[model samples]
Target: MCGIGGIWNRDQKTVDRSLLQSFTQVIAHRGPDDSGYYFDDDCGLGLGHRRLSIIDLSSAGHQPMASGDQKYWLVYNGEIYNYLELTAELVALGYQFRSHSDTEMILAAYQAWGYDCLNRFNGMFAFLLWDSSKQLLWAARDRFGVKPLYIWEQSPNFIAFASEIKQFTKLPNWKAQVNPQRCYDFLAYGMLDHTSETMFKDVWQLRGGQYLTLNSDRQDADFGKLTVKQWYSLPSNQQDLSMPEAKQQLQNLLKDSVKLRLRADVTVGSCLSGGLDSTSIVCLSDQLRQESANNIPFQTFSSCFDDLRYDERQYIKDVIAQTQVHPNFIFPNANELFEELDHLTWQQDEPFGSTSIFAQWCVFRQAGQSGVKVMLDGQGADELLAGYTKFYAALFANLFRKWHWGKLVNELITCRRYQNATEIQRMIEPLLPIWVRQPLRRLLGYASETAVPSWLNGSYLQTLGVTPQVSAKFALTTPTSIHQLSHLQITSTSVPMLLHWEDRNSMAHSVESRVPFLDYRLVEFAYSLDDTTKIRQGQTKAVLREAMRNIIPESIRTRQDKMGFVTPESQWIKHGLSDRFEIELQKAIASLGQWVQPDVLQKIFQATLDGNSGMQGVIWRVISFSRWLKVFDVKI
Candidate 1:
């Protein structure tokens, strides 16, 4: 809902007001209504904020908001949905508020509870707080990583942070360089889910569910010295709940979560795709609409690809028939929007190769033109619940590796995920850990960053010298490092793609979008479910589908494929983008020096042209990285 940026100087110089101004100006689309700044010379802290004003549309909500005694000043991005409840609790504990803004409530809550306040917050957020009384600076992102926070910490005096990576460019002496290791991760898997390491050398993304406490003094601000801690983590399975119980609980949680997010002074709408998640959200939202009897009803926007096989128009029609919500279509033709590519690339702080991002961008653009300020989306359901087919495949493989072919084949045939039980059993043989597979289910996850490909045997993402532990850290659902999860095929590329796309395109037209499915509590609740229920009985999200049995259509709710948001990159590479592919590859090779093997690169490009899907992964990585460099002036 906002863009937060600031700098901390150790040796207190006359603060460069323009630097702060530039930081705020670049991300104006994030918070277009107003801007605020807070500076403390003694503490060497300067905070800049651009407010989108979703919660409270009043001047009282204007931020760089300070506490009652002006002892703490804060700039935050995201909504604290439980602000009212927290406010009542805070007031009970002698904390007072003058503004009816969530921002003000955050300042008061932090003052009363300090860092403990984060545990009580239930919404998405990334914020920086300067404790005037204590001279301490704190920055924390949400538990689910709904919002983004980027930081630059080369030296203490140069410690800076921003809501978007582009805001970092506003700093006085910023330079752009690719962290080679990050590029390697991108090539390995379309995301870099590690800590602070971005495509830009010094600029780093703050991992979700993590916080930073740093000193302003350059000499004292050693990363080695600061101890960053995570307030929350996703435990594999701490609860011993049954699948039926989980399905019912998930349904209730999702409904209530949607109910809370339905709160808006302006009109509410939703992003609907042919998939079960989006359709389920739309169905539930429509039911809420019917109960409210507001007569306003809800609106639905869906994206359409040129390929009929991938298009979900029939599914959208099914939902529309039942709910009768006014549905709009945002069609994306790769050939047509190639011109918009440069601008769309710029919206993302780092480079993103997925053309599906542009498709999401088109959805928000339509949302803005339709006069809707907020929209709900089903973004994180896959990661939280076991929606991807790959999980089961991995599980089956893991079992087979332990000579449990009987159990593995039974699962494969029941899940109906693969053909020929013996073939699948053979395929899964090498996947087991040296240890037992029945208990641990050691398998090659479809999202495994450490799993090297045939062509990727010596790929840079592996040899570029980052630890597989680091790679694994990024791939985790919980927060340790931000990069891994951010780029998790589910979270990194898909979730962030929708978020950044919605944020920019909606803001471009002065509309604000909200996603309830992405609520941290919902995310936590989903991740907490048993993996067995997620991909059970030859069904992905087995519990999730059952939960919505009465709501979403049987066809959509029972969908077997886990195609969330994707484009035909292979088709584009060969026919549509042939010329652009040639030019971009040449540029990437020439401009990026020797980061990738040119022989391998040409082979990859030719493979795409020849209909081989093997190189699609690395080609997209190189192309996305190359395009990012060309646009952002970033270099290796």
Candidate 2:
């Protein structure tokens, strides 16, 4: 894993080495092991990298690594778990390698297969390859958006790309300016994955499963000349399979995915939350480890909280007992959440939606301190499998809308008995208008329907030319099958934001977090299966339970609650943070009047302090944005 950045001057002026070095140094936390730079003065092209040695510990793995012919150079970030396999295939094709590094495999693969090499990859990655021979640049992000890459077209003739947006700030003439539209979207609807646009105005992300190519020969700096393509997309057609067949296929695919992710040379551990997803990974990984000659205990990391509602210590202990794994726990409270707000926000590069992110931050920090370099996490499982209660409601609503009343009634009864029919109201939720739904959702502690918070300034939104409603790109859709909802959640909605948090939090501690659930094959297979296979007879992740039967602990396997890295934000606001929170909130209101109504914020603050948990979302969003504005010196 590494942090990579580069500059390609279309104007053909040599890039200043010091400027490149400075920009690369900005993300040193992403890669603390080694650093290198490559520049071609004549072509005005430069690439810099900071490496966190995982696959190869020797200098042989150093990047910006070059091809044997020196015609292509790669500054890469992320691991290709299947590199050893790809290496064998390349060697069969007469390709030679100087090192066991995946970086070398990438260079040789590109030499033999060109851009087609991307198809053969089965890992998380983002890379900028300088094709000196072709006078072009090729950039690609992994299929599932596991790794992040940000791009800024500084000028028509100059382009810069980095693993983190902070590096872009180091470039001369670059000012950290807030993108008002994204800010409006974030504050109003809590939407962050609606588009490629970032909170920073000019900087944009290279969307996952996508690639960009630039021709140095085209002297015109027109952004229009950039050719961006979606190299991979989810399978749209669902597959017809019986429960047994589906379970077998899923077991094989998921096991292979877990096996491949455990390919790193350094000690690799798992993040266990005692939840179904994390516990499943830990159990399966431990099972795999035991089968192999390596008999050492695998390390698992988790966050234990004082608040019982937010803690999963019992489940964590259950999994550890079953798997016989070493368990490490960190207790993060309101003090740590408030104390590390600024630095954590800085690491995230954008404002997170809630305090739960701090819980994850603490987990990763503990992993790094524990001398574990690579950690396996269960991030994308909820999206892939129909694990969220919201999905259950969505499936019911879709059935009712389609006049499948018999099925709907049967499922509703089952849900009430097994999973609680709490989400049944979501069946009629879409019929209500936004104005009514917004208040109703808030009253019920469900998600808010309106895009913007009630406390934001209406006039400011008008000036920004956006609305409180979610952007059309992100407007929620009611799908007929669990598979369809899974695709939408994974690609267009929730998983992207979660992936962003995982990348930033893990990288902040210089640790690599791999998600086995995101393995494309597993995601695709889950999407192809029927909704019944995923959420059957009121149980979420039913197919997963069936597949892991007798393997995962019964406590986690039978769990109905879904607390994903959860924190007690509402309680924290109501009790622990009244005094200091009011002080900071008042400062934010004073500094942020142009974007929010001070009177409304004050009311919300008072209501929250008065023990209204519904307003916690608003309080957290406002404070997070407020702190983000200050930490990044963001100009609105």
Candidate 3:
């Protein structure tokens, strides 16, 4: 994977070649191997690329690559795992290639099939193609949003796009203005969005599953003038199939997805958290390699902790005992987190929700140091397959809504025995009226608290303004059924947030992270299955358990407790980080007084100091936001 940046002058002014070079240099870490540039004076468009050189090491693979006869130019980030198949198909249709690179295959496919080539691609990507022949700019991102693409418009006529928002800072007129509404949403509701709006004013993230087309000939264009379209969407049509048939279909899809992601010229490894999602990736990868007579030990990276409650070493050991692959472990501590706090915040480019993201950052850093270029991960499984405890509520809600009382009771008992859960409140939740239950859920933090936090300055809150509903888009609207919930997780909520963190963390270390579970075919197959298939017998990801029954050790396969990438944040706040955290908290209050209430902030800090562990997360977010402000020198 690599970083892409470019500028298009809609007013047909001469493009600044130096500006492209400056912005592209800012994200050099994303692609350090080589850099390329292409500028067309006639169209006033410039394209720049930073290459990581994964597939083919030869110069033939270099990009801003032009097609023969110079009709098209392309800059791309990400791998096309199915390039070989597409290449073969294209050649049979009279297409020719110069290099054994996925980039070339993409160009050939586009040439042969035009925009229709997007539907045929089976990998993560954010690409921009300059069709000089058509005098149009075509841009697209991968279906699952595994890759990032940001767009900024200087005016209706001039546009700039990049792989990261930081690249935009190099523009001569670039201003770092804070988006107050986004800040309010983030602080009040913890609403991290996957929508078009970004934290920075005038800069926007292109939603995943969407593409852009802009005409070179259009004069004095505007944001609305760009023809943006959603080409991909999660499949909602349920197929008529038995559980057995669905399981077989899902098994085949996953196997093929894993095999395709294994396509790389450089060394590949995987992140193993000892949870079902990651363990399945590691074990399945090893099994597939063995089947292909490639017996090289697959490298697995994990973060372990001294706190047994937060550690998954036992489950990790179980997977190791069964597969016996090469393993690498990291003991991430509060010290490392504190030391890298500012750097991590800068890398993320935004305030992240939790410290669990640091554990993932450490995993990617270790992978880079170990000389692994591409790391396969299990990021999208939980969202696609209802693999969280929260999904249990959705399941019970469905049963109660359907008047399946006997089934609900039987499942509750089975869950109590299997998961050792005593939360009877969940089983009784569906019986309450929507009005009464909704407020109760919000009070318990089961729903996002849209009410302004007690810590916000009243003046600032009033200045930020209020609406009857400012959070409808960011709110995780409760789904009607377990299937619909899983679908929303992929389309709107958890998976998108998780993917954003994974991409930023991995790319910070210059490593490409591939997620097999996010393969559209696999996602479609999983979502098509009945909710009972996913959470069978009170086990989340139950179908996955059945598919990997003999492959993964029974101990890990049947694990009911899942603590994926958890950390000792509360402990750190109370002990190891008390002094520094207090200092940072005070600094944050002073720096953000206009937006934050100093008295309320002090009270929150005092609560954390008084051994209220839950209050530590609030302190962390304040510290993160403050650091981000200083790092970016942001303006309100």
Tell me each candidate's TM-score.
0.87, 0.96, 0.95
Between prediction 1 and prediction 3, which has the larger lDDT?
Answer: 3
Candidate 3 at 365: error in angstroms?
Answer: 0.8
State residue 183's C-alpha deviation in candidate 1, in Å: 1.1
State which candidate has the highest TM-score.
Answer: 2
Give stretches of model 3 more than 4 Å off.
218-224, 418-431, 438-450, 466-468, 609-613
Off by over 4 Å in 2: 218-224, 418-422, 431-452, 470-477
Task: Summing lDDT over every window of 10 consecutive residues in candidate 1, give the lowest-scoring window.
Answer: 477-486
Any idea what lDDT model 3 has?
0.82
Model 1, which residues run further than 4 Å from truth? 216-227, 397-407, 417-513
Ranking by lDDT: 2, 3, 1
Q: Which wins on TM-score, candidate 1 or candidate 3? A: 3
lDDT tens digits by residue: candidate 1, 175-278: 88778666656655566444456767877766667898775433443522344788876544445579789888889989988888877667889888879888
455: Cα error in model 2, Å: 0.9
For 292-326, candidate 2 gives per-residue lDDT tens digits of 86776689999888878889999888887787689
Instruction: Please tell me which model should have the higher lDDT, number 1 or number 2.
Output: 2
| Predicted candidate 3 versus true structure: per-residue lDDT over 1-636, tens digit per residue | 999998988565578878999989888888989999999888789999999989998999898998876899999999888999999999999988899998988888889889999999999999999988777889999997889899999887778999988888888788888887776666655556556777788888778799998888544344226788999988678776666776777778888999999988888899998988889889889898888888666899999988888898988988888885899998887877778988887778777877899999999999999999999999888887888876777888888889989988887887876554435565455457667767776665443334555676646667666431465444544565788888777876677778888988998999999999999889988888788888776788888888777777888888888777788877777778888888888998887777777787777777777875356677777777888788877885
